[model samples]
Target: MTAPASLRDHAYQTLKRRIVEVQLRPGARLVERDLAAELDVSRIPLREALRMLAAEGLVLLVPAKGALVATFSPADVRDLFDIREVLESLAARLAAERATPDTLAPLTHRMAEARTATVSGDLRRIAAANAAFHAEIIAMAANPLLSNVMGPLAARTEWLFRLTASRDPVEQCSEHEELYGHIASGAADEAATSAFAHIAAGRELSITLAEKWSDPDFDPELIARGRRRRRVES
Candidate 1:
């Protein structure tokens, strides 16, 4: 018989899904007692899950303030995309040099799904398919270290995409198709160039949307004060 998942694993998956889907918005406080009760898990496992999330850059643990969803600034967005562009571009180049027909097949299928999602105007599906397509490229590269580094960044990218909701799905799918062609043909330089352009475009869109949606009066000090008061009350 298969072993049951541990409580910590379950909590981590559930909380990560919620965070990625924006059920837990940026900067939302995660009270351990409430979350433990909600998930029907004890505090010990929940705390372990929170630590894992924090390590992945999805959660922030203040000294006495418990956990909160990680917040993004324009600088943060820029930094993330900058690193993503470099790493993903390298991944594309490596995939172009290494990928076989079998490795490329999954990306081709995902591109079709992304195209359909684009036409249907399903943002969530578009996002998922897009992420899957890129993930396939990373897998094709066959570097464990690269995969490990890109994993959390990919999750953060998903969160940014959901928050912005600004990508043109049709354009994105077209770009992916182009990128796939380059990789399939073993055009390493072209594949790297295409990947960099794709991520650079996304970075701009994310930054623009972030600026539009950001609160004008958002004060970190005020939030810290509120957290302190809550801690005192509890």
Candidate 2:
């Protein structure tokens, strides 16, 4: 029989989801007491969860200050995308060479979901579908080493996307379709090249958006209020 999840695991997943989804924005203070009460978990498990997230680069724990959400600078964003471009290109190339119809089916389904999500005009769904599509590609690559490295990078990438929130659905869908075509056709070189180009473009866009939106002295309270307001409006 499968083992049940522990409280630490549960807290970790909950906090990680909130961070990735931007409910807990970058650089927001993580008060242990508040979080413990909010999550209805004991301090021990919550601290363990924060430690796990910190190891994954999702949370920051300072010497004097307590835990906070990880913040990405423009340079950090560029560096991450640069690494992603290299790794993801390799994944696409390997996927093209190795993927069978069974492996490719999930990607095909995710592409359709992305298209539908694009038309629905829900940014959250669009983001989720886009992530699912790329994750499927990585899974098809069949490399545990690559997946392990890409896992944390992918989480950071999703956080960046949530911050920018400016993707053009039609354009993104078009690019995804093109990439999918190369992978499905088993064109290894083409798949790698396409993946590189797609990520490079995203890197540029993310950098630009980060520069435009970033505030050096960002106020976490204001960010929290804005998020609350957006939630109510939606």
lDDT per residue as tens, model 1, 99-176: 788888877787788788788887776777787788888888888999999987877777776676666777888899
**Which segments of model 1 are wrong by more than 4 Å?**
1-5, 213-234
What lDDT would candidate 2 get against the real structure? 0.80
Candidate 2 to truth, TM: 0.87
**What's the lDDT for residue 128 in model 1?**
70
lDDT of 2 by residue, 1-234 (tens): 222248788888988888888887677778777787777788888888888898888988765546778777677788988797898999999999987899898889998998998899888778778888888889899999999988877677767767766867778889999999999999999999999998888777788877765567765444433322222000
Task: Quote the lDDT for 69 in model 1.
Answer: 77
Residue 91 in candidate 2, Cα distance off native in Å: 0.6
Residue pairs with backbone overlap in model 1? none
Each prediction's total of clashing residue pairs, residues at least 3 apart in sequence or on different chains, is: 0, 0
* Residue 13 accuracy (lDDT) in model 2: 90
